[model samples]
Target: APFAAPRGMVATWVGHATVLVQAAGLNILTDPIWSDYASPLPPFGPKRAAQPGIKFDDLPKIDLILLSHNHYDHMDLPTLKRLWERDRPKIVTSLGNDTILKAHGIPATALDWGQSVSGAALNGLAPQAVIQCGSYEHCPDYQVHVTRNHHWGSRWGADRNRALWSSFVIETRAGNIFFAGDTGAGDMGWPMQARRYGPIRLALIPIGAFRFWKGQMRSDAHIGPLQAVDVFQRLGASTAIPIHWGTFRLSYEQWDTPPRMLELALRCAGIARKHFAPLRIGQSLPVPTVSAVPIGPKRCDDRAIRALE
Candidate 1:
């Protein structure tokens, strides 16, 4: 599928954890993988259950790429190389991952949790003194913050946690966006840390591949629908779009299970269904601008709100 260039603050779910975010006049891709398989080998491992929402050639000029971890599914080297050669987008990932990317001829800036890197430096642009405001044309300075999440990173059998795993908090001119690369509900307080950065306008959270051994698995590395909603509430985001599902058969759950379960979870949590979106493989939606006006009280049932209390 080919995507039209989105004008303002917009996001497109290109399957799995891959999302295309167009905001602040810059285009960003999250955990982009357009390969046929999310495996170490081309012919083996988890083959993509569906094609990427937007074709590679159809992508607009990408300003940055966000990598959450080193899993083959999330870090497809072939696609990364292609994008690097084509768009020369600045790549950001957790610490220790930069060495891996550098060895593969792709340069990236690696940061530890709570550390941040500016897009201007990443894109090789010199710092400017004047602020020329026009649609993203002036290349507004953006900041990508490496934040903590409950996840592990490993590309091979012997290298577990050799590279750090994390989520990202992107502060753009339009608003703040949180991209949970891949995370489990760890301590239930990790999401709260993001709140200090300010109100989150959009949240991209994982909501699939959680069922293991019929619930026997600890699921300490991936989050399901219920936990996703919990993370959403913790961040106090204005809108939430569920990702990391329905693109690959990584678990025992059915292809349509995540969204269906997410709907049930949202209803049970007393959150308005409109606040949570389950986008199609190639769907793009405009994000609401963050406003200073206070939001009115939610319409959730008192009983539903009390359940969390």
Candidate 2:
């Protein structure tokens, strides 16, 4: 069931926060979860409303994996184990989560905010200053950067925030892509920090699980449609794809509400509807490269960008 790889940047929303990003000749999966339920127990917890877009066996060779956090829905151990045994892809996650994976016998590279791991380790060839492939020529060393996000992580109720959570900015030959793992609008400054990476080509952002108790309980760890637009505008990505919705019923909002709200929010924000793509499960869309003219004015001070580099 392997589909032909897109020649340029492409993304497929599997479900919830899981997205398959193909770029620079590398196949990367974000917060991969193919389990039937987002629970410790198979029969309990939020069951998947829809099956994963790409069947487990059908996934193309996965070169890398980006684990956003340790939440059950975002970090499914079974799926990780399966991919590990089959593909042995390099898994990148925020700090402390590596311990969780190590206990399960999965090796991962854990990074703190602003840290990154290169692709040379996963190339299966001798370390080289530059790795050339048919899909990417003169590609900069593929890098997965761990960036801070406004989110908490825990498996059990008592151990909240035991592991740091993160979003990722992947530097690829196609373009720098941002993956908003799972976050709420915290001070709204984190996205601006991410924007410093500049010229993001594709952004995978969350838009669901925001409406809790009809605003009785503030969703401190998730962003709504309007907030998603805010994040998109801050990141200044060429295209934004909405995720983390319609897969499991994890909040009070009705299923199918996120995408609908996202459309309206885009209109209100005066952003082009095509800029925010809400893909259905099992659907894949091409990611356009960054334009010659950047999306927004560069905000990162020259010194800050250099420091990040």
Candidate 3:
């Protein structure tokens, strides 16, 4: 896009579900995980195949941090603490995760579904570019709402469902965005969420780490390309960007399968290939965004159309 990025809003894809969103002149991060490994250890478990796109020092000034859940891949304590110590961005997340961040000196605020913080214009700061929480989760003033996904939520304990797992319905001057942290094909809650927060301007949905355990491990956790397309249609969103792929081989599919399949499925659905994107790691796309060309019916002019079948 040739337009200058106005101070009102902007969103950048860091890697995985981690995104850098600028709204109302505020730089915000969503489900930021910068650690080398998505595990409790340093040398074992799923290690990141690609290096982080946003270096710690090079990150723009951050004013807010939105954590979607407690999964290690979604929430990294070390990364959170670093951001907290440097910028002290206000942390907004589901219930109980406040405790998790607080343990790391993050001083997070918790919110439940249907609850939210009041809207405000850019002030540059509470005195210094900081937004304060309106009230507690159970309070009537909170403005954030929680939505469900066909995914599980747990962190460092056996208490699954103990902490509320959800996605965010963010209303900015730019537009409304639905951030689906991590979810599976069944997506137990998006339909209801779409009914509530439907017509989202942009949807940041998960698209990888799904295989083998499609019915057991992450059985209800991750979605493949077709299911991802369903998510895009379910929300009635303007644009859908696929994440959670190619960064780590957490699933049984080939490393290159996601983008290829996503393109194929988008075609099969008669949706334009550009509408459903699998962006390169660390790259950003201007949202409320669309395809470059007007997509047409499958022309038998090339092998591209044949691959869709």
Best by TM-score: 1
| Model 3: per-residue Cα lDDT over 228-263, one tens digit each | 877777777777778787776577877877778777
TM-score of each: 0.90, 0.88, 0.81
- How much does each candidate deviate from the true structure in C-alpha RMSD? 3.7, 7.6, 5.8
Instruction: Give stretches of model 2 more than 4 Å off.
Output: 1-7, 121-128, 131-140, 216-218, 292-309
Pairs of residues at least 3 apart in sequence or in different chains that clash in candidate 2: none
Clash count, candidate 2: 0
Q: For model 1, what is the error of residue 88's alpha carbon versus the real structure, in angstroms, after optimal superposition?
A: 0.4
On lDDT, the stronger of 1 and 2 is: 1
Candidate 1 per-residue lDDT, tens place, 1-309, comes to 233343347889999999998886778899999999999877889999889999899999888899999998899999999999998888999999999999999999999999988766775666672145344555658889999999998889899899999999999877899999999988988788877788998899999999887643229999888799889988988888999998988898779878877776787767766678799899987887664323344545676455322
C-alpha lDDT values of all predictions = 0.84, 0.83, 0.68
Weakest ten-residue segment in model 2 by summed lDDT? 131-140
